[model samples]
Target: MAKPQPTDAQTDAEPENTEAAESEARDPAQALADIEAAFDAERAEMRDRLMRALAELENTRKRAEKDRREAAIYGGSKLARDLLPVFDNLNRALNAADDQTRAAAKGLVEGVELTHRELLAVLGRHGVERVSPKPGDQFDPHLHEAMFEAPVPQYAAGQIIQVMTDGFRLHDQLLRPAQVGVSSTPSG
Candidate 1:
């Protein structure tokens, strides 16, 4: 028996339908492009997230280090401040002693001097420093507290005429500001 041939209606329908079916099949190049585009988008997003997390971690580390340094520098500020008067009294005693008296009390004076020196050295080792303002230096508000403004024509205005108390510093932090008298005169 002979095989039946397709009708005209079936033939016409096949051409249109065949083209539609062929187009629906995946194109290797287009599929590869789409896959690459998706991969690229995912990689970029992940990289952005990673960089932000790293930056935040670095910032946190820096802040912690700063806090630790500050704690080390100013930990004994109250105790150190309280000891200032003892040092002042020692200095005053040494200053008031005359040569004959100092010689007679040499051993005692030397002992007190040695103790005072050792105390200052220990404080210096721990980042504590004395700020001794000179008689003619300019008065700085950050390091000097003006107790009074004196009228003196021999020095320039704002010059430190007197320093009532010495200042102290623990690293970059001020433990105490120097008590000073600023000049009111305009010229030397």
Candidate 2:
């Protein structure tokens, strides 16, 4: 028996049928390897993305914690700054009482002194410290505010000649710089 030849339509359809034929013609092991490699590449990319996301989350958490700590420490800064003048007035009142005033009003002077000391203790407990710069100490710009310059014969240039008002600090932060006079005279 003789077999009939394929028609023109069937011949055109042969190319379209090659997709199945090509897969069957290729080595099965090679095809499986290609699929496995594609899956491995996708898995690696996903893992990399996941790791980056986790690192970003960790960094955000650390930043939030640091911000919280800073807020806790510095939240009362405005209130502390406002109270500095009250502290200054107390010191001035104590200084105004001389020996005669103390003799005449010993009880009053003692009460004022006690009040001043208590205020200082309260401030110290809250981390507020006075930056007291004595006369003849080296002038430090970081802790002292230069209110005036004087050419005192006994002091060298840049030395503190007089302290006007003491400064206050809240922990490591300076709330106010100590007001002072710096000597302009050169050391002979």
- Number of the top candidate by lDDT? 2
The count of backbone overlaps in candidate 2 is 0
Model 1, global lDDT: 0.87
Candidate 1 scores a C-alpha RMSD against the true structure in Å of 6.4
TM-score of 1: 0.63
Give the runs in model 1 whose Cα sits over 4 Å from its true position: 1-62, 186-188
lDDT of 2 by residue, 157-179 (tens): 99999989999998899999999
Per-candidate RMSD, Å: 6.4, 2.7
Least lDDT summed over 10 consecutive residues: which range in candidate 2? 19-28
Per-candidate TM vs. native? 0.63, 0.83
Q: Pick the candidate with the highest TM-score.
A: 2
